[model samples]
Target: MYVAVKGGEKAIDAAHAWLAERRRGAKEVPELSIAQIREQMTLAVNRVMAEGSLFDPDLAALAIKQARGDLIEAVFLIRAYRTTLPRFGYTLLVETAKMDCIRRISATFKDAPGGQVLGPTFDYTHRLLDFKLAAEGSLPDAPKAEPHIGPVPHITEFLNKEDLIQQEPANDKEPRDLTREPLDLPADRALRLQSLTRGDEGFVLGMAYSTQRGYGRNHAFVGELRIGTCAVEMEIPELGFAIEIGEVELTECETVNQFTGSKTEPPQFTRGYGLVFGQTERKAISMALVDRALRWKELGEENVGAPAQDEEFVLYHADNIQATGFLEHIKLPHYVDFQSELELVRKMRAEAMGTMQEAAE
Candidate 1:
């Protein structure tokens, strides 16, 4: 409403220069290369790709470098860049059972097929930080095995054979693609899963934790958690055949939660599902818990008014790019608004003093 700030371009340029210098830290210290980030900081790159919903590790690494190691900012960059890409045909749904699992385990069963391969996990390692790695950023390579080529079986099939778990009827209906359309309320299970797949890892983790803390108790057991590479296929209309185009790393989780019989339904165990873009077991497990909580209505359970139970709340706030943008907007100048508040306070003080003087007289 007021005159535009005159020298903003110059000020912005100067501020940006300062920021660049700060980001680099020191000229003498060697700069971080994209390769170093891609290889050494693999987890960060994976997280960015997971949240960004883009599978290009190289592009993600570049974005991470440009964003100065801010994962949320890197995600934003990747999202913006992704929108410009031309729409292509969709890929086929990945087959988890056929996954060449690098790591697979089942908590509910002791003798799961593939025999609980503890492939590359930090679960058993001590928390102590070895400062020796600071000087020499390398270690003696651990033993590696030729991966099992045959299909590793799922633990759920065993329970399904017994008819102890609730049967999930196959629904071939096309799921709503949230990426192409604006999000709508009363989202379906697929839509909710889409939101969670690209949602903030920490936010999803915290919401899942709330369930364990009695906010919305769903006694969850890790029925199966697997991390592996799976083939990505697309059906070529001209060829009339689905052919493998590439492969992607994925972390898939299935949780068996408690179930109570309703008046109309028989008692059986319920399920929660999670599938993330990479080896992110914690995120995947957490995603399953929150995913189950949001299904209160579908499960015929009463609304406990828990945060995770609110689908609208979870889906809306799950996006990190939106969250960071709106939150960071407050840092912008609010000169006019501040001036109005300052004038009002000054006037109120003056009037108060005048009234007190009159009363004294």
Candidate 2:
């Protein structure tokens, strides 16, 4: 797909300079600082971090600023930068149960163990724009409450206690890495989860929506959704133990799917899980639905040929970087390629015309 751009060193340089100037916009206005983007435009930063498969907020914010607020372009920059960094050993498995949750809610039960905490949510806010924000004014500090003392229990635990939910077997084996190796078909749940976690938000959301709209209907209930920071631990081989390296903000969703019963086993509700970096609640919820849809085979349910159920279709097109690269390349210099296509069309038309003329004669 590489097209040779004959020669335009000066022109290219000028274009780069122009782009930089345009990105700065109106010299009078203050240029947005990286910290502002990191703190203020946090949601945008989170999306970039999720898609870029990188967890660095400052770097994600820098990418967002450099890309002129184009999130996809920012993700592309972050991904490109990610390749140049040295690889470190993988961290230990994160335990969501022990996460210091800032926000926790359950759609299934009105009263849950840890109690529903609607922390810093836009759920109750009206969509109307406030003109007051346009003016420079300070707002009153938000009310604060004491943090919860013990580990927040999962909602699925209630269903599990009565054997109402299917129990997934624990496996200690290391899962395959999609980044390290070529993606093969019939991907395990681990690999699929890895791809979905970093997949395009919109694409995943659409696929998940399709399933709910009867494409592959599996009634889903949000057993619990939690948003908070979890400590990331990395094992030190020298010390022979793991140590807390850092903490990362995360959103996790657990869905209780419809029950399946057979002659051999009793009816039990199934589960779908989604975990992503940052407070991307929507993405996390969508991911859980899609994950459940993709589990038809394992769940002993028939695949209804749904888009979400098609592993190849979902995984192949999930990556925005790959999709954008191929799509945007069409706008690039395709002189040689277009000329060949033009010649072929002309030849076909000429042959058809010649045949028609001979028949008329």
Best by lDDT: 2
The positional error of residue 130 in candidate 1, measured at the CA in angstroms, is: 1.5
Worst 10 residues of 2 by lDDT: 141-150
RMSD of 2: 2.3
Candidate 2: which stretches are off by over 4 Å? 1-5, 145-150, 262-265
**Scored by Cα lDDT, where does model 2 land?**
0.90
Superposed model 1: Cα runs more than 4 Å off: 1-7, 346-361
Instruction: Compose the digit string of candidate 2's lDDT tens values, residues 82-102.
Output: 889888889988888888888
Local distance difference test values of all predictions, in order? 0.88, 0.90
Tens-digit lDDT string for candidate 1 (1-361): 3432435788899999998898788999999888988888878988999999899889889999888898999999998998999888799998888888888889999888778877778898898998879876677887875555557777887889988888887989999887788788888899899899899999999999999998885889999999888899999999999999999989999999888966655788888999998788898999999999998887788889989998988989999888998999888877677778888888999999999999999
Collision count for each candidate, in order: 0, 0
